[model samples]
Target chain A: MDEFIRIEHLNQRFDLSEPWLARMIYRRPKKFLDAVDDVSFGIERGKTYALVGESGSGKSTIARMAVGLLTPTGGRVLIDGQDLHDGSLSVAEQRRIRQRLQMVFQSPYASLNPRWRVGSILAEPLRVFRLVDGPQAEQARVHELLEQVGLSASDARRFPHEFSGGQRQRISIARALASKPDFIVCDEPTSALDVSVQAQVLNLLKQLQRDLGLTYLFITHDLAVVRVMAHRIGVLKSGKLVEEQATEKLIESPQSDYTRMLIRSAPRIHRAAS
Target chain B: MNGEKSAWQRFLASDFFYDFKRSPVTIVSFVIVVTLILMAILADLVAPTNPFDPGSLNLMNGFTPPMEPNAFTGETFLLGTDDQGRDLLSAIIYGLRVSLFVGLTAVILAMFIGVSLGLLAGYRGGWVDAVIMRIADIQVTFPSILIAVLIFGVARGLLPPDLRDELAITVLIVAIGLSEWVPFARTVRGTTMVEKEKEYVQAARLIGLGSSQIMVRHILPNVLSPVLVIATITLALAIIAEATLSFLGVGAPPTEPSLGTLIRIGQDFLFSGEWWILLFPAVTLLALALSVNLLGDWLRDTLNPRLK
Candidate 1:
């Protein structure tokens, strides 16, 4: 299968102790920690792949490494069937890759700088990547994005703090959209919002995904959100991937004990039967 | 994506400039500091007499009392004349000019050293950070003036006695600037340490930004607000340190009378009951320092997010 995003035997290890202290205390030359222990996964074009795990399961690490945020200790990540990152690339190549992939951070409000007005924040990627023609033309698109995200164009004048939590996440989503990226790594985009807002944001993500033909590597500990957004789910445990299957199969018939426990523990809300 | 229109408009409309106007003290001090800087920048056109011009001196006009008429010159001196027969008003303009020059040069030099070292230490974080921080700590133990003095003495000592006088001001500026740089470096290092962990920095790294670009573009802008506050306050401190050094006869030459040097020159006649000689320059220094320090305080309050 032609994967949109592919991770191959990726491993990340951090030096837990300083080199000097480790050497001096017991001649333990290097004190290392395996943050992501040989994790691998793939997401096909226009697909959503979710990594569901408890905290410290190395889910975030794997997600971060896949995007080339953290350098892997070993292995490779191929975005669009090209190893854009093995260690490092030329500046021009990196910029090209960044244009294709964007991120939505967990604390939606904190992710966008508070000092910046919403309109400018949204337009930043457009100007940085030179995606648009001029200021006047870019301003037109800014209004369009604000409208698309259910925000009035007048609201663009205000800062991030001025908006509600749900509105802020929408603004963040609009910002990610501004880059015209095909793949987005959403690191718990709705974790900081209320339950109502979470569903609203999740639904918006689904709509945008279908509309824009976007692929997502959605990272979250919340299994319910994973169920709603993910096409496939990979369960992680202690820096390792324990199971991988279709979202329906994983939810209905979880083989791994950790996955079963996670499914049991996830909060469910009552909905009218279709 | 259209950074220009957004940033400019926000800056114009923001409470930043309005906050400066809210306090009367800050307004007055800002005025004073701006006036002093203007005077220093435009010294020649406004000064009553050229203090540096040797042939213009009238020995008979020397020691004329403040606001009193000079007997031999028959000129009503506003602030009187110093023993060198230079008009006290003109001498002050000259003095203020020298003090400002030294202070500004030193601050710029210090900022250069501190900021570069700080960016390096913070971004590279190993033996470099340790060495820089330890050096800053060791320097901070002694008062900065002493460090300036020690550096000046060593630098001047290495030069021949004949070249020392000509090189004194440059040497003094270097000494004061190098000594004061530790605070800038320390503050920048602390800020760099915090900023390096931020996700945007990680994002930049992911996008394959070089370490230099990460430090310069991503981290520098975030760290600059604090550095600005520190720079403003340090400007006042740097000016004061320059004055103090000059007053001790180790600063500028006698031909170039900074406020501190003028005060030291006037001290001789203080006991002779020629009090105006000492009083006016002393008050000028007080006013200059107070105004600058006040402005620095206001800048610190205004720039800080916690206060806003």
Candidate 2:
């Protein structure tokens, strides 16, 4: 199995300290929060690798680092065997690596720019990557993207505010897919949507992945979502990757107490006798 | 075609338009501002006489009362003539043109400088943010008028004696622009800080767009609503500041008299028997400033979601 994306010994430390003057007056030492503590993971090509953790467990930090949005204090991310944060890489090389990956942010409300129309939003990545030629071609590509995301071509004329949360999330997915990326970092993509809407979005994501042969770095706190979406799961505890295994194997017989607790705590539906 | 029509209809039905229709003060002020701007732009064609031309001034027509024939020339002045014998209505019209021009150019200059600096500070934090914001903070400590006056004085002193009068308006615009930029920079910086944190901005960054591209393409649009509101309010302030400088005899020169210079000339005869000399131009300045201020206030309230 080829590793499509690899995060090696990643660490992120944020200085959470008061001003220098205040610290000196109070005689306090500088403080830091280790958000991601030397976590290492690799996702196989055409597979969903989910990172499960509660809030503040550094799930989003890893997600950000995976997508090259944040530079880690230590360690490096490699995409398709090429260093993503390599200072030696030229601008064109960096852009080439960046073009192969995209991010689907958690909040549909915040992810899509409010001022932009749906057409422009979808066209942005296409235009940036030079995926299409001419305005007519761009419009046609935008229309195709909208339809692929289960939206009408006419919907492209509307603003993000005019769409429902699920529809907006679909638009975000469409935008992520616009660049025709192989690897997508979905940082709790359905976490902000309705429970019913979440299932639909998850299904759409699964369908897209199957059709496109894409790899995913799925970040979420919900075990139920993990059970349904992840091929392999990495359970995180306070910035550390405690356990990682195949989703079913981990769910059936977890090695770590933390993984066991997580599985047990997840709500189950009782079957009714007919 | 149908979509475009509905979008237009939606705009007409938006809260902004609804608010505009509901408030009579906003309506009146909007009308006043539009009328004043149009009159200023069309001053050359609209005014009965070219007040700036020395050939057009008749010494015998000086101090002619409103709508009354002069005893010597039997010429009737609409608003009444100043001591210089320039037609008061025409002078007011031309004065308005100068004031509006200075005000507009000064605001544009301030907005350009302020928005750029603010975008830089907010998008690039740490030392870059610190340097820009510290300057803004220091500038904010002094009254804007004092800063304007200081800049105006230094600029005037540096210019050649012969060029002083010619460059006075340009210098005045720069001074007021420099003074007023603090507010715009401060506002934009605050907005940019918030906007830069948004996921959309992060998304733009993820696309390998340069920092400048993200700042200009993604973050700038998000931060512009407040900037526009600030720009509108600052226009009124810039106009008032220009007038204040001119009134102090440091602003627009006597040759090309702005409203402030007209008021200065009018004030000389104000204490004497010729009261209309002071009254008409003063009234015009008041109306222009007040209406712009009211329109700006309306815009601020309307555009700001917090206010709504």
Per TM-score, the best of the predicted structures is 2
RMSD of each: 4.4, 2.1
Query: Which 10-residue window in model 1 chain A sums to the lowest lDDT?
Result: A265-274
C-alpha DockQ for predicted model 2: 0.80
C-alpha-based local distance difference test score of model 1: 0.83
Candidate 1 has an fnat equal to 0.21
Clashing pairs in 2: none
lDDT of 1 by residue, B133-153 (tens): 899899999999899989988
Model 1 clash tally, residue pairs: 3
Give the Cα error of residue A231 in candidate 2, in Å.
Answer: 0.7
Please, what are the lDDT tens digits per residue for candidate 2 over residues B1-308? 24556777988978888999999998888898899899999998999999889998989888899999999999998898988799999988999999999999999999999999999998899889999999999999999999999999999899999999999999999999998998788888889998888888888777767899888888888888888888888988988898889999999998888999988888888778888988888888888888888888889888878876
List ranges where model 2 is wrong by over 4 Å.
A269-274, B1-11
* Clash totals, every prediction: 3, 0
The positional error of residue B51 in candidate 2, measured at the CA in angstroms, is 0.8
